[model samples]
Target: MNEAIERSNPEFPPKIINGCVWKLREKSPGMVNKPSRGVFQLLKYRN
Candidate 1:
């Protein structure tokens, strides 16, 4: 999921930080700032 977004937008963060991943949504006309969205996941990484 993260990989797909990253592939589409290089600016996307690779992994969640502090249990959350922040992203900017597309801006519309008359919008003062871009909306931000967060994806939280308790991911277990295996090495």
Candidate 2:
């Protein structure tokens, strides 16, 4: 994950995911596991 992010944007900090609210799920593969609360969330990034 860090490698991909760095490849795309070298200036991107490694700490970006540190304080972020994220989850890992076995069924969803490489997706963020949190549920969307409303319509606005549907357009948000999933993986």
Candidate 3:
């Protein structure tokens, strides 16, 4: 079975989306503070 399966990318590992979401929600607190939302928004929080 291992031989039949193509090798996965070495750079990135598998992750649980729900766990990641929970962590982000807990850490950041504010909904609009996420980095991917925008650089401008992140700067907005700084001041």
lDDT of each: 0.40, 0.43, 0.40
Model 3: per-residue lDDT, tens digit, 1-47? Answer: 12112244334333443344436635666643445532213334654
RMSD to truth, every model? 13.0, 10.0, 10.4
Quantify how close model 3 is to the true structure by its C-alpha RMSD in Å: 10.4
Candidate 2, superposed: residue stretches over 4 Å from native: 17-47
Name the candidate, 1 or 2, with the larger TM-score value.
Answer: 2
Prediction-by-prediction clash tally: 0, 0, 0
Shift of residue 28 alpha carbon in model 2, Å: 9.9
Q: What is the overall TM-score of model 1 with all chains considered together?
A: 0.28
Root-mean-square deviation of Cα positions for candidate 1 versus the true structure, in angstroms: 13.0
Q: Give the winner by TM-score.
A: 2
Model 1 misplaced regions, further than 4 Å: 16-47
Model 3: what TM-score? Answer: 0.27
lDDT by residue (1-47, candidate 1, tens digit) is 45566678787556652223333223222332323244323223211
Minimal lDDT window, size 10, model 3: 1-10
Clashing pairs in 2: none
Q: State residue 14's C-alpha deviation in candidate 1, in Å.
A: 1.4
lDDT of 2: 0.43
